[model samples]
Target: MTPEPNQLLRPSLYVGALVLPLLMSTSALAQSAGGDWSYKIAPYFWGTGLSGTVATSPALPPADVDASFGDIWDNLDFAAMVVGHANNGRFGFSGDLQYFKLGNSGPTPGPAYSSVDVAITNKIYSLNAEYLLKTSSTSEVWGSIGARYWSVDAGLNFSAGTSPAASARSKNTWVDPMIGVRGRTELSGDLYLVGWAYAGGFGVGSDSSFDLFGALGYQFTPTTSGIIGYRWLSVDREDGSFQYDVEMEGLMAGVSFNF
Candidate 1:
């Protein structure tokens, strides 16, 4: 028997809520011990562009209608993460817990009116591991992999004068496998430049997607640093009325502390 949609999403929420706290606690303990553990907390912001296709089938009397390139606009993106790294000045390992939110609103074609207002929101949580491939007195390179939990909700609300006067909403969840690379190079005594890119996919349902990012940072001390960056993320839904595609590129700044 197939599980209900809510049934599937509920478990993901529960698991994320339970695991996030545990990871945070473990990271804290490692920090107090002065082990090869370090943590970074940062807030990120992005501007977004969105577009999608909506299909209405004949069974619904729409005769297989298609809505293309629905709408595009700039969006405010927000994200925060707690990351821990263990680097013995050479071989290294890292883990991260991250949360992100993206939202946008715009005008879309309506049945009998010029357009209707639509809004979309996306929330994601990720846990990942990294390995350093190379480290020098001024630069270091690393690769990473992990699991991502994602949730998206989208809706359309018609104007008061639009025909049929309607609204629709949808939600989906997925577990994606992710991989990426990162590097850092010193620019001064207490400052460094940083950059990274990550991509992932969910093979089942409408969860397939990819994300890429790049950033630069400044070290305030031996164990603390601040960074700024940009990212682009996209996801495709295999079975739905809508095909999802979004591009987010903007400013992100955050801090990291190593123990």
Candidate 2:
């Protein structure tokens, strides 16, 4: 006999309730064990370029208009993240919140003939259930899958000389599935090396697009680590055309704490 619709929903609801509390309790226990939370912070600098129809606009003037445009366009791309982990011997879990920002001066010679600046920012939060494949007194490897919530905003500013400026902004948000793998190796008694790669996608305002990032970290203690790394991101715009693409490449640094 087939199960009723209500029965099917009940089982999933029960499973979610059980799993969520168990994960929460485990994390709380880790925090009390000298495995308390820790944090890391890093900032990077980079350059960006625009392509497609947006790049080909006739409003922008020539590229060599001002030195300030060159400097602003090439500088200040960075990402920041904070993460927390909880683990028993063989299994553990982690959650992270991250932010990234990129900006550049649009090429001159567009229809406006005024200098235009573009800035894009992304914010993401994720929770993952992890399984430790292997762990020794000195090293560990793990993999995970979970859910992610993300928000992105893009803004454009137009300015002429030192006068007033005008701007436009667009924003989007979505939830997606996420997965990752991470590993750590002891370099010495108090020092360790760590690395990870995470991939995910969101469907909002456009067809689902994915993001992938890799990072490296150095452990200061069993519960705390400092990290520095790079991320490359590509997104399909909501414009419904092949002519618009949003891409980002930059450096990132952050910290993680295990509880």
Candidate 3:
């Protein structure tokens, strides 16, 4: 038996309702603080390939999915991402939001199905507070604590010969508390290496989620830079009827401005 569309999306809706307000409140607080605030905004492109399994309800077994960056780009219908940072002295706040909607058509198992189409929407938001532990003209390091929220919606439609199309959908959302470190080192003249890694979800929201990134950046001007990096991120979560164990990794490039 297939689940209703609304049934699959309820979890995400609930999570959004609970978390969005917190973000707004944090922003308000930051603005009201009287101090010289420095800011940075970075917009980037990630050519991430997806490799994962998605299972909905016990009735439907997990399906393996493998898509290259090329495949993902072809199916991607919409995408938006932004990373923001604000700092006052050694105390600071950073946040990033990423959203994507994609669709693909392929073959599926079982004699009852001739073709399968899947549409997916994913949103990931992270907000963190960090205190600078060390700083120098050539390097800096910070310790961070934050929460990351993930919400996903997937719709699957199956085509069975001589039978009407059958559709199933699922949505799930969770928030994980994470601790990590971010740092940068000057490698050469106007060149730097930057990296960050975080792990969370010790049975709190999901079983576990880990994110890692390393980038080489070059300063183009006093307040602008270009960055190229490789990133790996994975998540394993089982909440009631929704289950997902997935990993994404790829190359990314972006531009940043500091003011």
Candidate 4:
């Protein structure tokens, strides 16, 4: 069933209400330096575990997964991730790209099949426009509005033993609206911290979603830093024959290069 219009409008309106004050403050702090933008690029790694229920095909029932990074690594095919940021005075923009693939094979419980093979892949992209809320020599905070695009594919093949071999595959994609805050501060000489939290969806796109990350960094040089962090992400949505309600969390490591 389609959602009521009001269900969608309410969250957007709420986001607007909260952002109004931030806009006012940003205007007060707006500077004339439009051409003096700074940029940074961070390539990151997340060793994550996925836990929850998922249904990729209408012909299959939802399955509960509690796969650890180790479990996934056993069958991992490829993975890549990077984040980029650009700032001009009090205004900023950020983007992230991440993708990974996994394949596994195991014995089946039922006598009809001798074994089961599975393949899964995920791709995510995020973009945000932000305004600096407060800034100082040692610390800075920003408010942001963003969107995340998610695409997932899953496939399974059953080996014939007592029954005929069969295969099923499915793919789905969606985008979610997000709003949140992010910041960083110096802890001591050559040491610093960074993180961000965001919540969105509100039935406008998916049902709901949330993302959070925190990290500690060591400055290697004026233009480079190495960071270790933890990240938690959750997304829930079921449209038509597709369902993906899952949470992912684990260790994160990265290097940030400023330019």
Would you give me the overall lDDT of model 2? Answer: 0.55
Q: Write the per-residue lDDT of candidate 3 for residues 2-84, one digit (tens) a residue.
A: 23466436534544464466556655776798787777777776766666776665655455566666575655454445677
Off by over 4 Å in 2: 1-79, 108-115, 136-138, 158-167, 188-191, 202-217, 237-245
lDDT of 1 by residue, 136-157 (tens): 8888888888777767665655
lDDT of 4 by residue, 40-117 (tens): 878776666666666666654455556666665555454446777778889888777776554556666667777767
Ranking by lDDT: 3, 4, 1, 2
Q: Cα RMSD (Å) between model 2 and the true structure?
A: 13.2
Q: What stretches of model 4 exceed 4 Å from their correct place?
A: 1-34, 69-72, 103-118, 158-165
Better of 3 and 4 by TM-score: 3
Better of 3 and 4 by lDDT: 3
Candidate 4: deviation at residue 108, Å?
9.2
Clash statistics: count for each candidate: 0, 13, 0, 0
2 against 3, candidate with superior lDDT: 3
lDDT of model 1, residue 186:
81
Residue-wise C-alpha lDDT for candidate 2, range 1-259, written one tens digit per residue? 1235674454345434544565567556666775433322222222323332222223332232122323534533544455556666666667665655555565545444467776666676678888988878887888988887767666667776544555656666667676778777777555556667766654433344455555556777776667666555555544421112555555555555443
Which candidate ranks first by lDDT, i.e. highest?
3
Judged by TM-score, which candidate is best?
3
Deviation (Å) of 208 in candidate 1 = 4.6
Estimate the TM-score of every prediction.
0.69, 0.59, 0.81, 0.77
Q: What's the distance in Å from true for residue 221, model 4?
A: 0.7
